[model samples]
Structure formats: structure tokens, C-alpha cells
Target: MVNLLLENGDLVVIEQSDFQQLLDVLAERTYQVVGPTIRDSAIIYDEMTSYTKLPIGWTDVQGKGTYRLKRREDDALFGYTVGPHSWKKYLHPPVSYLWRTNTTADGFQVTTAIEEPPKLAFIGVRACELQAIAAQDQVFLQGRFVDADYKARRENIFVVAVNCVQAGGTCFCASLKTGPKATSGFDLALTEVLTGTNHYFLVEIGSSAGADVMQAVTHQPASPAQIEAAEALVEATTQQMGRTLEPLDLKELLYNSYEHPQWDELGERCLGCGSCTMVCPTCFCTTTHDTIDVTGETTAHSKKWDSCFTMTFSYIHGGNVRTPLRSRYRQWLMHKFATWLDQFGRSGCVGCGRCITWCPAYIDITEEIRAIQESTNKQEEKIGGKL
Candidate 1:
């Protein structure tokens, strides 16, 4: 396979034909091949035994309030945008057992939990997802208390990233400056190139492990023309993004917008159902609860995903801190765009737009931001006139 390093120091690529062979080899090594596939009319990640399991000849159309699948004339793998699932399900897990308690002669004893490591090869990873992974890393790994469970799964994963050839209507990664092309945190990267008479992939290797995979595949050296073609594809996709966020100073803007009236308007339509947080790739909040069987002999404690929209999320000693729907909406938006920067040195949003697509009431974050900005500007103009 043509082995060229891209601008990112941690990704590699292989030709389409050779890529199939690489997958077979990785499978033999016992690494579970997880990639996108067509299921229930949408592209979702599942166990892939071979290249046939990939979502070939399929693409998706995504918007602020809609999503649908379309068939492509040519067979191409990794041609779709991000779906409802993310790598977090595998790494963080929706539910996990912290520990168990048992009755002992003297008292109750708590037993430590044991987790097995699974070798994972994640295929067709997008640029926004890479950033999402990085954001979770901060929450679970780099914090004061590192999550042992998350750390183990993350350490065992091998990422195969794909540069977006087409952007979803709901995507705003370009505005967040997180995607359209993978810049880091990948072992390999690929750009699928399709022309009138040819279909192939331009591959680049980012890590030693990725180079080892390339050694197993048969490929030819990429020419200058192919490299140029790859660059042009990325540029076109970047320009095709359907949603855009303004270039205001995000942190200052959101912090100053706490009292904005748009929050109340959005709250009226919001169901407070928390679907957006569930679909979001970067949301990492969770809550814990205990359960007992009917026999009363068995008990278990579990941690499940949680959202800021829930009143319990903001529970103080006596009552919830943010009581009104407007306050809850304001809290979620401000934390994502402003406070997240202060905490992680980056915005919590990767611009995947799941927040817009999956919301039951179709609350569009981009439109909300614009409305707030306009209202704030008008208020400022009136104040200046009075002065």
C-alpha cells in the first residue's frame, strides 16, 4: 500500500483493495473489528467480521430537524456521517458495576470489580469523534480521580480515522474547528477517492502500529496527482457544511448572555427529555443508583448516563439550583460553549449536531445562538441611544 504520512503525526492510510486485506489480518489477530453498517435505515457501528459488513453504497442526509438515508450508485465504504452512536458506548459504557457487597460473619464486605481488556480496532472514525474522544479523556483520565474502567478500554483501542468527503446538514464542525479532516489521535487516516473511471483510497500512516497494518496490505506508491485530489476533496467538503456558528468570542459571548430572552423561548419548546445529551458524543455526565432483587438476597449498583436538563442534576442540599426551564437551558448552553473552554481549554461541542437532530422538539443550537446574538445587539443599541 502507498504509505505517506499526513500532516497529523498519528494516522495512516491504505488503498481500498489492500484495506480489505488489512481488515482480515487484524481479525486474525483477535482484534474486534468495529465499523459503520446499515441497520434499521441508518449507519451504526457493530461487529464487522469482514469488509462486506461495512455500509457500502450508502449515504445519509442530516439536518437540524431531519435525517434520511440515500443509496449511492458506486459502492463506497465509510461514505456516511456520524450516527446516534459514538465510541463512548464502548469506552465509558452506558451502565457499569462499581463494586458489590456481600454479607460476612462480622459485617458486610465490598468486593472489587474485575474488568477484562478487549483488543479493539475502530474503523471509519470521523474527525469530530476524535475530538470527542479527547474531551472524554479529560473528564475520565486526566482528572483528579482517573476512571480505571475508562482508562483500560481507551488504552486498548486502535483508531482508523476517515476524512469527511461530505458534511451532514446538521454538522458545524467547521465552525468549531474540530473536523472535516482528522488532525490527531488516530493510528491511521483515509480519504476515499472516486472518479469517473476509478475508485480508490488515498492512505496515510500516522503511527508505528498503523505502519505494521500497511505492511500486510498490497499497495502502490501514491502519485502527486492523487495527493492533490485528496486535498481538493477535503476542501470541498469543508465548504459544503450546512450549518454555521458565528465568530464571536464564544466564552465571553455565552457568559454575558446568561440573562438573554432566547433561553425562555427555547425552554417553551423543549421537552426536557434529554435525548440531545444522550446522542451527543462529548457529553459525559452520569448518575448512580442501587437496586435489589425481589428475593432480597441480590443487590447491584449501576451508573447510567445523565443530563443537565434533569432537576436531580442540579440538586443542592435543600433544593435544585436551577429551578426554571430557562435557567436549565441556559446552563446547558453556557457550559457547552463557555465554561467547557475554561475547564478543558476547548469547547465541549465537536459540532456533530446530534443535539439538533435528535431533540424531540427540534431545538437548533445554531439558530439559538444567532437569535441570542441579535437580541443582545438590539438591547445594546437601545442602551447606547439612551446614553
Candidate 2:
């Protein structure tokens, strides 16, 4: 172990062996280290005990409504892009027990669910995913009512972010300025460099915790040339994106094109299965349910992840506000691009492209946005001609 004190903004290089030791060090600190692993023919985030469990030499091919795993030419862990699972599953959980109520001799008594939050150290987090985590923080932390569960889980997290060296077929983070390289929101960021007969990682310390962890691992200061090489790889990744979203007047476009025909066309292709929302890292909507006993003396309330695509999501006293499938689709898309900025200060999407990859009906949001732009342009052209 190197006995040097590490600090934020420091760049270091760790060989493959030291990289594995980094995992051991984090685990020794009593953190539940979660990372990307091959499971059921797909890369998913799960409890990773050893570095060998990583998806080494395996990459994923993704497209609208399709995903597959392929073997890489060399053994390079963290070679793949974002998969169907996101970090939100751990932070916000699929379901949470809120509280329980029981009738006593005098009156009703309530017991709020309280438990210790797990100390988690996430590995292989991408840049766009970091932005997604920040977006959720805005929703659950900075909002009027802070989410106790989200806060408890988020406060103790140790993030190990990965800089993307290759772009996925569905990725467009470069266009959104959310990724290809992680800039913040992590304890440590890694850029993998695998050359002939050489394999190593260029690590960036973003926080003191990351620096402390590095003290236990064997590493050396990265040379300027090594840093440049890592940067060149990230630049190449930015250019390799299979999709791109031009962020010009997007909020205004969605807000103004409320009745655009492109939405109806999208409705015909969208399956409303909620797969996109489930895979999206930044989507945070949820619904609560209560269970009552036959005697009506006890009740248990719980919350589960929900989506605006569901018909029941917009249900109210009289009926569902978004009855039509087109309306539901419009609501979801508009919220991400338009209303979300009004609610929060930023766009909801981080451009990870999981939604495009997981959509069973092959709906591509970037293409949809382009179509809306074209339609708006044509409509304006006709109006200008009349004038």
C-alpha cells in the first residue's frame, strides 16, 4: 500500500491488481459493494463480492427495443454502456413500507417503519447516471418534503463512477452534456485503458473519501501522457454515440407542440408497458397502497414505483385525465422535456438511453423529438406564407 496522502482532483494510475484490491478495501470497510455483472445474458447491477464477477471482456449491443451481449476481443471490465438497470433501484427502492396502524383499547396507534440504511459503494457508475442521481436528489431531497428513505440511503453512499470509453447504440449523453466522462458526484472516477500487453485504470479523486480509499491501494501518480490518452479515449467515445439530441429550445418545443400530430403517431407505436420508466435512472414517480385486515383493526401502507404511462396514474375523482394513449405518451414526454424544468430547474433526462433500449415497441425519444421539430417548422412555414 502507498503511504501518500491523496486529495481531491488528484490523478493516479492503478494496475489491474490494485484495482481489484480497491474493491477489497471498500468491502473491508463494511460497504455493500454493488457493480455491473453478467446475469441472465444481460449486464445488471448486483452485489459484487469480487472484481472477477465484473463483466470482463463482455460488451452489450443495444438499439430501439433490443439488447444483446457480445464478447470483446480483450478482457476489459466496464467495457459496456448502461444496461436496463439503474442505481435508482437501490437508492429509491422498488417498494418501501411506510407505516402500520392498529386499533388499541382506547384508540388507534401508528408505527412508522424505521430501519438502518445500508452503506453502499457503487462501482462502474456512468456519467449520465451521475446526473440522473443529481436529478433525483432534486426531487427527493431539495423538494418541499424531503424523502426520508431516499435521504437515508443517499447520504452514506460511496460512488465509483466510470468514464465511458465506448458509446452504446442507444446512447446520446454527449448531446445532452451529461456524459462520456464523469465530472462530479462521485468519490472516485475511473477511465480504463487496455493496450497490448498492458491493462490499467486512470483514477480521479473527486472527494476526500475516494482519496482515503486510495491510501489502502497500491497506486502511482499518473503521468501527463497517460492522462491525455485517457482523455482521447473519452473524446472518441463522444463522437461514437449512435444517437444525439440537439438541446435547442426543447422545453419550448414540447410545451408549444402540445397538439402536435407526431404525438398521435408515437402513441400508435408505444406499448404503454412502463418498461422505459422502470429502466430510466431519473424517473421518480411512485404510488402508495394500504392493506387492511378483515377486522379493519390494522392497516399497513407501502409505496411502489409507478409511471405516468399507466392509465391509472392520472386517475382522479371523476376519471383519468389522460384517457387516450396519445395523451399519456404526451404527458410523459412533455414532462421530461418541459414541465420538469418548471418543477425542477433542469431537464429530467440524463441521456443514458435505457428507455430507447428497453422499449418493447421500439420507440426512440430522439427521433420523436426530431419529428416534432420538423412538424413545427412546417406549420410555421405555412403560417409565414399566409402572412
Candidate 3:
């Protein structure tokens, strides 16, 4: 092992073999190392005991309501874009118990389930994903009422970010300034450099923990040439994005288009299956459930992910509010692009584009927003003509 003290923001180069050793080191330190792996014909995050488990020599093709896995020309591990899964699945789990009540001998006892959060080492996190995690941090941790479970899981994780060298067919992170290159929010960031007969990773240490991990790996300070090569690769990827969104005053646009006919058009196409929310990294809405045993002596209360697309999501004592599919769809899009800013002081979208790729109806958020803009402009022109 090449032992050396490394400071935050220091860039280093490590051979592909040494990258495997880094995974071994994390395992030795008792971290449940999870990363992207080919599973069920998709790149999903799961327990990866070896570096070889990474989606090596494989990339994905994504489009509106379409996704597939294909082989890459070279053995590049981190060559793909974000897939159906996000890091939120681990940090803010789909299901968890809040508390439970039971009929005890004397009286009813309400007890909370105390489970230790896993010490997770997340590998292959993309740039937009880092922003998604940050957005969730604001919702669960920085809010007035902090979620204890999310906080516990978030505080005990190590992030290994990967810079994208190629954009997916549905990606628009460049427009949102959320990715194509990871700037922060990672313990270590990696840029894969693949030259003929050479393969290495440009690793950036972003925290003391990352530097400590580097001490056990065989690596050296990257030369000026190597650093320049890595930067050029990321710079070129910026122009290769498959889609782009005009980062205009989207908040004001959505706020004013509340009664626009575009909602009805989208409602006709949207399946209301909630696939988009399930795949989205920043959409965090949940509902609670109570499970009781046969004797009704024990009751377990648990929370699971929910979606505004569901009619029951806005249900009240009288009946399900937002009964029309148009209203439900309108509420979802408006909340994401408008009300979210008022609530979190930032846009909820990170431009990962999973929602576009996973939608069965081929619905695209960028396209929908553009349609709204066009409709509004046409209405203004018509009124001006009358004037």
C-alpha cells in the first residue's frame, strides 16, 4: 500500500487494480459496500462485495418511456447514467416502522422499534444524484421537524461519486446545473480515464474520511497531464447531453398556468401509475399504515412511499380530493417546479431524468413544461391581436 497523507480537494490517480483494493479496504472496515450492478436487465444499487460486480463494460440506452442495457466497447465500469434506482432507496427507505402499540398486562404500551442504521458505503453515485441527496437533506434534516430515521441513516454513510463521461438519452442535468460533473457532496469523486492500453481513475478527496481511505489504497498524486485529461473528458460530456431544459422562471410559469389546458392534455397521457415518483431521486412523499395481529393485541405503524398522482393521496373525510386526473397531474408538476421552491428555497428537480425514462406513457417533464410555455405565449398573442 502506498501510504500518504491526503487533504481534502486533493486529486490522485489510482490504477484499476488498486480500485479493487479500495473496495476491500471498505469491507474490512465493516461498511456494507453498495453500488451499481446489472440486475434484472437494469443497473441497480445492491451489495457489491467485489469491484468486479460493477456494471463493467455495460452502458444503458434511455429515452422517453424506454430503457435498455447494452455492452460498451471498453471495460469502463462507471460508463452509464442513472438507472431505475436512486441512492434515496437506501437513505430514506421505502418502508419503515415509526412506532408500535400493544395491549400489555397493566395498560397499553407504545414502544418504538430501535434498530441501528447500516454503515453504508455508496459507490458509483452520479453528479445529479449528489444534488438529489442534498435536496433530501433539506427536506428531512434541515426542516423544522426532522425525520429521525432519515437522519440516522444519512449520517452513517460514505459517498463515492462518479463523474459522467457520457450522458443518457433522457438526461438534462447540464441545463439544471446539477451534474455531468460532480463538484461537491461526496467523500471521494472518481473520473474514469480510458486510453488505449491504459485505464485509471482520477480520484478527488472531498473529506478527511476519503483521504484516510486513500491511505490504504495504492495511489499517487495525479500529474498535471492526467488531471487535464480528466477535466477535458468531463467538459466534452457537457455538450453531449441528449436533452436540455430552459432554466427560466419555472416557478412563476407554473404558478400562473394553474388553469391551463395543458394539464388536461397531460392527464390524458399520464397513466397515474406512480412509476415516475418511484424512480425519482427527489420526490419524497409517504403515507402511513397500521398492521394489527389477529388478537389485536399488537399494532405496528409503518410508513411507506406515496405519490400525489394517486387520488387517495389528496383524500379527505368527505371524499378523495383532486378527483380529476388533470387536477392530480397538475398538482404534482406544480409542486415540483413551483411550490417546492417556496417550501425548500430550491427547485426539487435535479434533472436525473429517471422519471422520463421510466414513465410507461412516454411522458416527459421537459416537453410538458415547454408545451405549457408555448400555450401561454399563444394566449398572450391572441389577446394582443384583439387589443
For each candidate, what is the lDDT? 0.82, 0.92, 0.91
Off by over 4 Å in 2: 292-298, 383-387
In angstroms, give how far residue 174 of model 2 lies from its true place.
0.4
Model 1 alpha-carbon drift over 4 Å, by segment: 1-13, 383-387
lDDT of 3 by residue, 36-99 (tens): 9999999999998999999999999999989999999999989899999999999989998888
Ranking by lDDT: 2, 3, 1
Measured with C-alpha atoms, the lDDT of residue 59 in candidate 2 is 97
Q: Compared with the true structure, what per-residue lDDT tens digits does model 2 show for residues 1-387? A: 456689999999999866889989999999989999989999999998899999999999999989999999999998999888999999999888889999999999999974678999999999999999999999999978998989999998999999999999999999999998999999999999998977899999999999999878899999998999899999999999989998789999888899888888988888889998899998899999999999999998889999999999999999999988899889888888899999998999899999999998989999999988888888899999999
Candidate 2 achieves a global lDDT of 0.92
lDDT of 1 by residue, 1-387 (tens): 344533434223355666678688778767899989878887888888888888888888887667788998888787789988888888888888777666667876776553786889999889999999999999999979999888989999888888999889899889888888988888778889887866777777777777676666676666788878988998998998889887468678788877777888977988888888888888998998777667665457778899999988999899999888788888888888899989988888898888888777878999998887778788889999999
Ranked candidates, highest TM-score first:
3, 2, 1
Worst 10 residues of 3 by lDDT: 1-10
Q: Which model, 2 or 3, shows the larger lDDT? A: 2
